[model samples]
Target: MTEIKQPIEMDITEVVKATGLASSAIRYYEKKGLIHSIGRKGLKRVYHRDVLMRLALISLAQQAHFSLDEIAQLSVNQKVPEINRNMVHSKIEEIDTKISELIQLRD
Candidate 1:
């Protein structure tokens, strides 16, 4: 008979390593409702593996100038689309303007 291997479960420390975010930031995101955690085991926080992907998306959205509240709105549902396209477009325009100003200043 062949032996089968079980998948390893990740803990909060592993999640921080995979997402490249500080532990505080993860806690803040959870508080802001941008991400959720699985019920804790003892004093340690536990999370599903999918949280890595959620944190990645959150970081990318923040880099694009979205506020925590706005990001929370976008992250509300994975099954249903929650992002407001117009809001995202406006934010993109704002970021583009800032980039243009920086380029002009450097010239």
Candidate 2:
């Protein structure tokens, strides 16, 4: 049987183009330990394709108002993050509460 090899690394420009994120945001995510780069490819950071999924998760969490620290707690220098279900539920409840408060204020 023959095995097929897949590309594992992507250039920073590819990532930025795919994710619609700026280079600075990618660098910020790297600095925050949310993602990892295997090496530099001519001044461009190279990352595993897994970074796309990680960045997507980070964006969703941020949209939900999850702090960078909170996201970091879920992921850090790890290929797969350990997500806390309880924490997600708590955040949901918090958002629901805030929405209710806002509705009351508007009425």
Candidate 3:
């Protein structure tokens, strides 16, 4: 009795609305390996609902001071089961260190 999750699909325009990213930006993410489109709805790129989460991760990673290359590596595929948890922890620690240093300077 293994449970399987169904994928929710959306056209590019809908994805744009959901992610607040322009079509070009979405295409760029797909090109950069951070996100991927499952297929085409006519001429529009179709993406799975999980793309929203991936986009959110990309945003968070940027705020965490991760480079595009690092983000791309971390978000290599639409299914991110291969992402290393240790690397994410390391980045969080790095952010924490920076925040602590800033606090020390402020105080």
Candidate 4:
């Protein structure tokens, strides 16, 4: 007898709640190739659990002003699968400069 693995499934609403992202944003990310759906049950979209982490990373990278293409490149060479340290450091510096400028304006 052969054992069959059941497909993991989650409702689109649950996915959005778990990820703290809007449903439309999820669809946009899927369309942008930043995320994807495993399959659909009726009209509800299902996704693999790993997608949660991927979406979180995408959100953080976007806040850091990293473009989708840059974020994709950062994911390359993924034996360990981490954001590129160099890119992250550069983004931090950019953010710091922006913050400093804002502080000066406020002063």
- Clashing pairs in model 1? none
Count: clashes, candidate 2: 0
State the number of backbone clashes in model 3. Answer: 0
Model 1: per-residue Cα lDDT over 14-100, one tens digit each: 788887889999888888877777778787788877777678788888888788888877754263447788888888899899999
Give the 10-residue window scoring lowest on summed lDDT in candidate 1: 73-82
CA lDDT of each prediction against the hidden true structure: 0.78, 0.89, 0.83, 0.79
Model 2 has an lDDT value of 0.89
TM-score of each: 0.78, 0.88, 0.73, 0.71
Provide the lowest-lDDT 10-residue window in model 3.
Answer: 75-84
**Each model's number of backbone clashes?**
0, 0, 0, 0
Off by over 4 Å in 1: 1-9, 76-81
lDDT of candidate model 3 versus the reference: 0.83
TM-score of 2: 0.88
Ranking by lDDT: 2, 3, 4, 1
Give the number of the best model, judged by TM-score.
2
lDDT of 4 by residue, 8-72 (tens): 67778888888889999888877877777888989989888677778878878888798888877
lDDT of 1 at 4: 86
